[model samples]
Target: MKAPFFLFSIVLLSILSSCGSNKELQERAPAQFNEVYYSQTENGLNLYIPVAVIQENRVKLESVYFRGMHSALNLDAEKPNLYVASFATGKGDKIMHEDPKEEYGNKAPQAPKESPFKIESDEAILVFKQNEKTKYYKLTGIEERN
Candidate 1:
């Protein structure tokens, strides 16, 4: 009888300790961004913009899509700190790559022909607005995935 009681008390203590540890872990986790804008093109391109990026004004886009291809106009910002542009089609979403010479020939790099959104920073605030209402998100540092 004594041995059985001792084992039951140990199990209860272990369960309580695990529950406390889980709560602590959740509190330490980073906060997630809540704002997001979902825009799609007539062809198939889809763009998802975070409100933090707009508040930070890191993006400057003229149109969402042009000739069935997603445009990366805001990517032309000069001396941008950390600008990330992502787009998706039927395949999947992908981060836009900035390759000056690869995409363009010897001629000077020109902005995309069409754009719908623009991102610019004024006093560390993102200046982005659209005709339609969109959700807002919290700004957080970029995380690299392995």
Candidate 2:
């Protein structure tokens, strides 16, 4: 009787708590971009986001979160309203593999360390600061260029 009622109350509370925390998803981002694309270079990957407009001047772009990594973003001085992020390739993964002594002395691999390089993919997350508040915006439909 009471046990089942308490279990149901706990489940209901958890669902409500999770739903209340995602307020940002319900709000719209106040910026616009002309296009978002990525190009592969010999050095690495270059992401180009041409800004059509930002809702306010106080909005400062911090970094671009893609795949599972975050890369710094900066405005291009040569091009107007263009924000770019460059990620170097050829870097090895974050996993660390220990060398085996004699042939069979290898233990389990160590936990992975987060990589500094960004992941090249179609979807990106734009992290920015507006009015001293940090927020995130999802950017999809990113085109790949040669």
Candidate 3:
């Protein structure tokens, strides 16, 4: 019937659209990321990436996905060709204000399942825009500095 055909078409479209093209995302980024590093400060973890944009088109660095968290990158005012992202590493003390009845109705939430494309601990996925298209570049073997 027409209804069944329509449902099948929708399902097919969904699957196709969900698939991303990673041909441009090489194993390593094209830019010069030789000094990409991170440091753990009292406030949080500060990531520093010194990039040399070589593409003809201007590359807009979007965000960094690291350690299961996504953070927006910002250009440092004092440094050129450098992008930085910060992650809060400290957790504040919990306040003693809660209601057992309102807390999930006495049922604890289920544990979160692992994502299919979970990022590695020592690697980061940089989401950027070039030529008006969004792209991802993986930077591996990141080192930590004191």
Candidate 4:
């Protein structure tokens, strides 16, 4: 009777110890990060980029509103052409754009309107097409965790 009970207890203890802890997972996944959070509109834009250095505790958050974005956000005034880009600790994000005007010092690649910049990770880059006729905005945001 005692032998079987001893073996079962040993097995249970081993299984419990072998199970990984949260801290260990975090250490193993040092670079693992996500966009975490983002929100934007015609009025303003918000982004959160967690620093790999800070790992899980710190993040960089920023929000910017173009000079004329307010009017467009409110549908009460005129807007101008605009563009934006960003990078973070998460997977990554990219915003490719196409235009008659060259941007990003010529290295910027022109993208097809059918498929706008694809943001698939922690880093992201976006371009705003604003003009006297600018009327609508395509807002994008991604939140991820693992």
Candidate 5:
């Protein structure tokens, strides 16, 4: 009985110590993108990307739109064409119309009418064609303002 109890105590202690180490690792981990973009539109599409995600070549967009429309958009690292994706409106997230998935059915989803740009760096860039000329808008991290 004493031997079993001693072994159980040792295992429990090891498990507890490992758990504490994991928490410390998470807390000390460096952020991928120090700053995030805040949506000025009604959809409230704010995206946060960590440095690790970018390094891993996997981009994840987090957003919070109204009742309708999709708030999240992901660009897989394996697919390069997806990087130069389009959007519904030239304006901000608020102007976006209904989600293509709901309208055309998930089977035949429509591409966004407007192609934003191919995200390849820390900054998010939006390219627009104005008066037969191309314009660029570089999105900076919101935290940088502070």
Candidate 6:
């Protein structure tokens, strides 16, 4: 009787512990890294991204897509089906590194630039970032697979 009860208690404890083990917050890598998606419809576009590339004190998500030119055109919920696109971005999350300055500490980095208007797809993650002298980011195009 004692042996049976001990075994049952151990099993139950193990089960309970495993349930909430992952519930606690933990530093997790970008869940959307290297992920991409695409869509092209009537007067519409879509691009799913889940990556990060910090440059010039800006996060400039590698996985998130931005719209418009240098003008910070805030995309609305209707802008792109973020829900269907996979991972999305928020204003506060422009970059995802601890220090913005450290990201571009490599050398006399060129100025920021923008990608020309010529995205030939619905779902796309194309961006252009410019800086002081030359074009820092010419065209960071991101294409989704399947």
RMSD of each: 16.4, 8.5, 7.3, 18.5, 15.1, 18.7
Model 4: ten consecutive residues of lowest lDDT: 67-76
Compute the lDDT for candidate 5. Answer: 0.36
What are the runs in model 6 whose C-alpha is more than 4 Å off?
1-32, 52-58, 61-146
Please give, for residues 1-146, the per-residue lDDT of candidate 6 as tens digits: 99999999999999999975532211332223454454443223445443443243533323223343222212236634132322222212233468877555333212233334333333233332333221122123455454
**lDDT for each of the candidates?**
0.34, 0.71, 0.71, 0.32, 0.36, 0.37
Expressed as tens digits, the lDDT of each residue in 1-146 for candidate 3 is 99999999999988887775333554646466657889886556778888766563666788877776667899899987888988765532333337754544232222333322556788888887777777778887899999
> In terms of TM-score, how similar is model 3 to the real structure?
0.66
Q: What is the TM-score of each candidate against the true structure?
A: 0.21, 0.61, 0.66, 0.19, 0.28, 0.24
Best candidate according to TM-score: 3
Error of 4 at 5 (Å): 1.0
Of 1 and 3, the candidate ahead on TM-score is 3
**Candidate 3 Cα outliers beyond 4 Å, as residue runs:** 1-24, 27-30, 91-116
* Stretches of model 1 off by over 4 angstroms after superposition: 24-146
Q: Report the lDDT tens digits of candidate 4 across residue range 9-88.
A: 99998888886331111112222333435444333343433323422233221222221221111111232211122212
TM-score between model 5 and native: 0.28
Comparing 4 and 5 by lDDT, which wins?
5
Model 2, global lDDT: 0.71
lDDT at position 57, candidate 2: 72
Q: Cα lDDT of model 3 overall?
A: 0.71
lDDT of 1: 0.34
How displaced is residue 53 in candidate 6, in Å?
A: 8.2
* Candidate number with the higher lDDT (1 or 5): 5
Candidate 4 residue-wise lDDT at 27: 17
